[model samples]
Target: MSADRGLWITLEGGDGTGKTTQAVLLAEWLRDGGREVLRTREPGGSEVGVLIRDIVLHHRGDVAPRAEALLYAADRAHHVATVVRPALERGDVVIQDRYLDSSVAYQGAGRILDPVEVRELSLWAAEGALPDLTVLLDLDPAEARCRLDSADKPFDRLEAEREEFHARVRDAFLGLAAAEPERFLVVDAAQDPESIASAVRERVAALLG
Candidate 1:
């Protein structure tokens, strides 16, 4: 890492939690404050990651949970080496839409992968790296689902499953937040976007200090 290397902050949440929107805003907020910030998202951040994302998110058939997890991890490994770590080494504030915790929550707990197995693989995927702060926008699974209109893309093989699956993912995210209060913060995302953004700004500002 460079002498003036920066911190990594990530935004995480279920499908309807507005992570995509907020990540953009947060990066802009930091830039406006004169901070060097790089904003990106997972499943597709680099060239390699984009290839992996096509297979994972739009695959025709149902993929096994373990296979899905590995795919996500692979993309993450490339993403970290190519994008995240490099930006951090350059002292740029790296804020991503999702990171390691998403894998643990969506694949490990939501899909019922052996927790221990996933954790070990997560370490490898991340190469022992972690974000300094993870903001999880928590919302009820059903409420979140309702936010996605037909204007949105059709559900993927993973999303075609029962609502129970997403409920599990939500619970898993909450559990992760509970386990790491300092590193993870869960904000109620059922609220208005502005309200959620306000809370996100406040928390991020505090952490950057």
Candidate 2:
């Protein structure tokens, strides 16, 4: 990547972990600093991705583990190509929700597939593009469940999964962060939103510098 290339930041965590909230805060912060920002998400970042998102998140049918991985990979491929890369090329900071890490956590560990294989597939799909920074909102699964329950909204397929599955996903996320410490900023999601946002901003400011 060029030194002048715009930053690519991905926020990752299990459902109700406040990835969306942090993404928004980061985007607003970047914009306040006079930076161009592109906010996007996987499985729905592009037009093609919208259709795939429906199938993967709302089909209400059994999807084989490998098949599910492939669907996510497909969305990642198109999203990075048509949405993410162009924003970076234009020197716009891209704050994305759920990148390949989610697949490695959800499909790989949660569904009992090989995390390494899932990561390799995603790398191939995105032509080896990795985020400049990945913010992981670490939270207990039970706390996340309680938050989701309080929302009283419909659960997407992933959110509706059992607690054990979510536990696996959280562990996988922590493992990924440990393996790539330089690229990850893990925060306690149980913190007040302002505190979490402050931590994220501090790390992001360093990158911007």
lDDT of 2: 0.94
- Over 4 Å off in model 2, which ranges? 1-4
Which pairs, if any, clash in model 2? none
Model 2, range 64-96, lDDT digits (tens) per residue? 999999999999999999999999999989999
Off by over 4 Å in 1: 1-4
In candidate 2 the C-alpha lDDT for residue 125 amounts to 99
For model 2, how big is the CA root-mean-square deviation? 1.8
TM-score of each: 0.93, 0.97
**Residue pairs in candidate 1 whose N, alpha carbon or C atoms collide under 3 angstroms:** 6-91
